[model samples]
Target: MRKIIFLSLILIGLGVLLSFRPDRKPLSFPSSRVLPASKKDLQYKTHSVKQSVVHTLLIPASSRFLVTPTLSPELSSLESFVQKHQAIAAINGGFFDPENRKSTSYVMLQGVWVADPKDNKRLMNNLKLRPYLKKILNRTEFRRYRCGQTVRYDITLHSEPSPTGCQLLDALGGGPRVLPELTSVQEGFVDFAKGKVIRDPLGSSQPNARSAIGITSDGSLLVVMVAQKPEAPSNSGLSLPALADFMKTQGVEKAMNLDGGSSSCFYYKGKTVYGKINQQGNQVRRELFSVLVIR
Candidate 1:
C-alpha cells in the first residue's frame, strides 16, 4: 500500500514539472490549410514546434521565381505584391532601411541590379558599420542561374560567380547562411569572441519572428516563416541556430535568413500570415522593400 502511494506521488510530481516546462504542449493550427498544385509541386504547411508556428511553402524546380521590388513610390506589403503580380505565393525578402526607404541587401531582377547596398548612404556612411562593410556587402544570397535550357538555384555569397555556362538571372540577398553551417558571425549578424557575443544586430540567440529561403537537394525551393505563438508571444519563435536545424530537418541543403521580425510575412492564394507578434499577442505588419514571388 505504501509503495502504491509513493508511486502516485511521484507521478503527480512529474506531471507538475512537465506542466511548467516550456514547449510541453502542442498547439493546434486552425488557420492552416493544404493547397493543391501539380500533385506535390507546390505545398504549404503550418507546423507547431515549441513556441512557434512554422509556415513552410515549397515550390518545385519547374516553376519560375522572381525577386520583385516594390516598384512603387515606397515600400509595399506582401499582400499588395501578391495582388499586383498575381503571384501564386510570396515571401518577404532582404533587409532595408526604413528611415530612408533604401535597401541594404542586394537584389537582382531579370539580370538587372534593382537594389544595391551601395546606394544606401545611411548604411555606407555610418562609421560604426565601416568595419563590417566587407562582410555586409558579401552576405549570402539566393541566385537563379540559366545554363541554356537548364535552370538552377543556389544559395551563395553575393560575390560568387555564376556557374561556367550559366547566366545569372535573379538574385536576392539575405544574411547568414542557415543550413550546412550557421554564418551568423562571419556574415555580420553577430560579433562573437571567447564564446561570448559582444554585438548582435539580430538578437541571434533570442526567439523572434524569422524568414528564410532554402534549396533542397532536389532543387526545390522552400520559403519558411517562423511566427511567434500568439499564446506565448514573449517566449515564442526560433533563434538562428534553431532555425538552421529546423531547415536542415526539412531537407534543406542550403539556406539563408531573410529580414525578419516585423518584416517577416508569407502570402499564398490570397491568404497572408505575418510573423512578428507584439507583447499584447497581436501580429505586426510592415511593408517590405523586396519579395521572392512565384507568379
Candidate 2:
C-alpha cells in the first residue's frame, strides 16, 4: 500500500513538472535543419508562422546565380527550369500576363534584354495603365554585376545604373522592393492618400502566397516562398508587410517581392513546393516566364 501511494505521488509530481515546461514552438527562427546538407553549399529551410510556411534557400557567395527566361515561347514550370539547368536550387521569377503570353517584367541575361516589357503590346497600349507606365517600367529587380573576378548581387530599381567598370551579368525584374523599405506606392503596387488605400493592384495588405529574394548582410542570396497553411484560421499566407518583417528578422538587408500569388514556388534537390493552395485544398501550379537558379 505504501509503494502504490509513493508511485502515485511521483506521477503527480511529473505531471506538474511537465505542465510548467516552456514550449519552444513559438520561436521566430526555424527550429530545425540549421546546418548545410552533406556535400551541398546551400541550405534549404522551412519556417512556419501563424498562417504560412516560408521556404528559404540560402546560397553563399561562392555559388553562382543565373536569372534567365525560358527558351520556349510559352512560360515554363519551375521544375523544368531546374531540370534544364541541373540547378542546385531554383525559384520562380518575374511577372507576366497569361492572356498575351508576354512578360510584364524585364529580364536581362548576359547583359542583353531577354524579356522586355516594352515589347508587350497589351501593357504599352493600355490606356488605363498609361499613367503608371513609367513607374511600372522602372520597378525593382535582382541584378548581378561583374568586375574582373568579383561578382556581386543587388536589389535595386530597374533604372538604377550598374556600377562603373562592372558588367551587368544578369537581372530578373520583380518588384516593389520590400526591404530598405517597402516601395508599394513608388512601384505602383498601391495608391494611398490620407492614410487610406485608394488602389492596390497586388492586394498589398492582404495575406497571400508570396515570393521574395534578398541579400543578407553577409552577402548570401536568400530566396523565399511563403506558402498557405490550410489548417489555420487564416490560411491565405503572409502579407507583403509580414513578409518584409519576416525577411528582416532573418537578417535580409535588401529584398524585393517577386511574382507571387499563384506564381510562387521553389525547387530544390528534386523536390518542388507550391505556394498557393485553393479553397478546395489543391495546389495552384503556375508556369513562370523566368526563374533564378543557383548552381
Candidate 3:
C-alpha cells in the first residue's frame, strides 16, 4: 500500500512539472529555433546545366514585358510592365565586388524623398522619416530593408513590408552596374501569410527559420527568398557557382545577391521581419547606403 501511494504522488509531481514547462512552439533565438515550413516550400526539379540564368517557372513570353520609363530610364526599365505603383531598377547592388562600399538605399515617393527609414525614428522632425512614414503618411510600418548578397531588387511601391528603411527594387538593371564579378539578379516580394516576411539571416542558425516573401512583378508576381546557405555567416555559403546550381535546382533562371553582412536587411510592411545575414547591426556602417521608400 505504501509503494502504491508513493508512485501516485510521483506521477502527480511529474504532471505538474510538465504543465509548467515553457512551450517551444516557435523556437526562440540563441536557443533552439525552428522555422515552420509552409506549402510554399517547394521541392523543384532541375536538369544538369551550369548556366548563370535558368528558368524556374515558365514565364510566358507574352507575359514577360520589359520596363522602359518615360522619366529616368535608369530609374526603371520594366517599360509599362508594372501596374499602379510599380517600378523596376537596373543593376541592383550587392556585396559581390563593392568592398569599397559606395551604396545606400533611400526612398522616393510621389514628389518627396525620405532617407534612412528606421522603425524607431521620431515623427515630429520634418528631416526625420518617422513622420512621413508613420505619422503624416499613416503608413502601417517600415524597417531597414534586408536582402542576401545575391538577391537584388526590382521595383514596387507601398509593397515594402517593414516601416523603417525602404527597399529599392530594380535599382540598376538586374545587378551591380559597375565592378562586378557575377551578374544577373531577380526581383520580387512576398508576404508571410499576412503576418510578416521571414528573413533567413546568413548569420543565424535556427533551422527552417529563414524566409522572405515579396510581390514580384519581375517574375509574374511570386514570393522569393534564398534558403540560408549553410556557411553564409562564415562568408563561405552560397557562392556564385553554388547559387547558380541551387537556383537552377529551384528553377531560378536569373538571381543575384544583395548587400550582405550588416547591410543585409528585410522588413515586412510593419515589422523588421527577421534577423540579418551577418547578425552584426548596420548602424556604424560608413559609406553606408540603404533604400528607404514608400508607396
Candidate 4:
C-alpha cells in the first residue's frame, strides 16, 4: 500500500511539472559551415553601380531569426519597429498598401495570421498581366514561406499556383512567413536544382534600389540591399537579372526580392544599415507593417 501511494504521488508531481512548462521551446540553430568565398566576396561596394551604394549582410546559419509584424494595424518605420520589438537587425518585408496600411501579400507573425490572401490578389494580377512573367509565372510561382519551430527554421519557396495562406500557416506549425514573391532562381545553375532561376522578362538595363533575401549554398541567410542617391538616374540600380546574378555570385542557391524602391530599409545592431534615397534626398526609412528581424 505504501508503494502504491508513493507511485501516485510521483505521478502527480510529474504532471504538475509538465503543466508549468513554457509553451514555446528554445531555439536550436544548425551547425556552421565555412563559406566558399572570402568575406570580400560578400562585402558591399560603394559606387558599384555608379552613384548607388550596395550594402550586404551575411547572417550566419546558426543565428536565430524571426519575421516580426506590426502590432498595430498602422504601419511603423524601421526605427519604431526595431525599438518596439527590441530587435538586433531588421529589413522591410513584403509589399503593403499605403492608403489602407494593409499588407499587399500574405503574412503570418508569431503564429498569428496578420494579412489574408485577398490583399495579395492585386500583385498576382499585375504579374499575370506582364507578358514576360506569363511563361515564368505559369511555370514557376514566386513565394517565400519561412517557418520556425524551437528546434529548426525552414524556408520554402513555392512557384505559381502556390498553396493558400491557411495551408501554408498550417504547414508552418504556427510560425511566421513573409511572402514577397516566389523563388527568384528558376534554372541553369549547376549547384542549384533545376527550375530555380526564372528567366528575367525585364531586361537587365534598368536599375533601382532593391532589397532581397537569399539562402547561400552553405545555408547562411543574406539580407542584401542597394542604395541609390535621390538625384541618381532612374536606371542607376541593379536590374532583376543583375540582382539574381549578384546573388548567385554570393553563393545564394535560392533568393527572393522583397519590396524595394522607397520601401527599402535595413537596420542592424540598433543602427540604420542601408536603404534607398527618398524624395527628400535622405535615406528612405519608410514605415512598414512586416519586417524580418533578428533578436
Best by TM-score: 1
- Top candidate (lDDT): 1
Residue 17, model 3: lDDT of: 82
lDDT per residue (tens digit) for residues 10-44 in model 4? 99999888877899465667656543545423333
Off by over 4 Å in 1: 1-40, 62-73
Cα lDDT of model 2 by residue, 119-180, tens digit = 99999999989989998899999988888788888989888998888999888888889998
Q: Of models 1 and 4, which has the larger lDDT?
A: 1
Q: Can you list the residue pairs that collide in candidate 2? A: none
Candidate 1, TM-score vs. the true structure? 0.84
For model 3, the stretches where C-alpha displacement exceeds 4 angstroms are 1-170, 173-218, 221-232, 235-237, 273-288, 292-295
**Cα shift from native, residue 53, model 4 (Å):** 1.3
lDDT of model 1, residue 115: 89
- For model 3 the TM-score comes to 0.28
For model 1, name the residue pairs that clash: none
Ranking of models by lDDT = 1, 2, 4, 3
For residues 175-230, write the lDDT of model 3, one tens digit per residue. 21111122222121111455645532232222221111122224422222232322
Lowest summed lDDT across 10 adjacent residues in model 3 is found at: 172-181
In TM-score terms, candidate 4 sits at 0.59
lDDT of each: 0.86, 0.84, 0.29, 0.56
TM agreement with the true structure for every prediction = 0.84, 0.83, 0.28, 0.59
